[model samples]
Target: MKKKLLVFTGSPRPDSNSAILAREAARAAREAGASVEVINLSRLRLNPCRACDRCRDRGPGQCVQKDDMKKIYPRLKEAGAIILAHPVYWFTINAQTKLFLDRWYAFGGDEYQCFKNKKIGLILTYADQDVFTSGAVNALRAYQDIFNYLGAEISEMVYTTAAGPGRIKKNKPVLKEAYTLGKKLVS
Candidate 1:
């Protein structure tokens, strides 16, 4: 069976550098024979977890709020791999991405073990020249730590610095790296 990849674009901008990179990766994944779905979180109305302890007690299939997140839960469980594409927001993922990650609590403890076996990728674009900068590396490392805690494999991490709007398009190496990462997901 072909692997399924779910990409979450955490940029609020419609055609921003983050989304562009994610689009390129999705295209590459499709070309490499993996089914891909890129979700624009900006357009979705996702709510933050209420810290109600509802998921922990009620468990497994229940989240108290009935919002757009209902649509994402199934996809989360179904995806063989997941990619998070976001611009460096103060050296980390945007608030929107963090919100979604927190809601993963809805998937339950042991029942959500499906996520443990999945592969995860991180694609981060920043507006400053920070290749040697610790900020971007720290952000990626935090994500890697989370995935590691969840038992997910860190498939790859692609980072581009000083990228804004159309600037990423001019960087062939970064784009190729995204494409290569996508191709790796299928292998």
Candidate 2:
């Protein structure tokens, strides 16, 4: 059976570089015979976690909020691999992305094992003229730290720089890298 992969783009703007990178990877994964789905956070109405500890005390890994997140939980459970795609925003993920990550606490804390053994990848884009100062790697590492605690193995991390409002469209090499990474994931 083909692997089920979920790609979540943390960029608030649809079709932004972060999402473009994810599309490349998802396209490659599909070409390689993996079933893929990409969730654009910009369009989702996900509320921030209230930290009431209700999921731990009253429910089975369910959040109290009634929103688009209810549709996402099942997808997370069904995915064999999960990809978090985002642009480097002030050395970290977007505010909504940070909120989404924080909301994962509803999974009965870090030891819930829902994400254990899952493969993950990171795709980041940035506009820093200097590659070293772009902070993409640092931002990616921040994501890894959370996934690490959840026992999710990061299969790969892809970065693209000098991407600002369609600038990445001129960089075919990086796009190819994204596509190749996706293809390799399922091959």
Candidate 3:
């Protein structure tokens, strides 16, 4: 709890392009003297929000579903900065990433006070040539709406077009951007 940053990598593919961006960012955050944790969503057993309204009453840690999400509740509350790195699929955020976002409803019990002023970052990868065709815009819009509603500060949103796994490693400028974002998030 109370760590500098928590990066959730939502790609199902291990070491994907989005994951590379997350790694670069995390490395820079560490160099900036920030504590960082990079969590791969694929490695975690996460369930979609059932919308049972259990968390809406008590807020924060009150969730009915017993899953890995329980482990994230306090960390999400305590992290100074949060980064969501994921690949776009079907013209929107991937399933796993969307599920994670949905579960943030649990934190709504306190009117999302846990997210107020929290620094948030996003790194999105898509297969198409640009944001539109890649459908990265869709995912970006969703994140914008979600974070804005939560009263969080979106430090940065960096997206790239990487057609295959780890292709983002070739995009040096984006990588550097993510690094800069990491430092800025903590500062």
TM-score of 3: 0.95
lDDT agreement with native, every candidate: 0.82, 0.79, 0.88
lDDT of 2 by residue, 1-187 (tens): 8899888888776448878878999999998889999888768898888988888865545888898888888788778888888777787677767777776787864465788888888888888865458876677767778887888888877887855566667789988888876776666
lDDT of 3 by residue, 1-187 (tens): 3247999998888659999999899998899889999999988988889988988776677799989999999998889999999999899999989888888888877788989999999999888888998889988888889888999989888888888777777888999999998888887
Selected candidate, larger TM-score, 1 vs 3: 3
Q: Which stretches of candidate 1 lie over 4 Å from their true place?
A: 132-134
lDDT of 1 by residue, 52-118 (tens): 8777777664688898898898888889999999877876778888888988878754656868779
Question: TM-score for each prediction?
Answer: 0.93, 0.91, 0.95
**Best candidate (score: TM-score):** 3
Error of 3 at 33 (Å): 0.4
Arranged by lDDT with the best first, the candidates are: 3, 1, 2
In terms of lDDT, the best-performing candidate is 3
Between which residue pairs do clashes occur in model 2?
Answer: none
1 or 2, which is superior by lDDT?
1
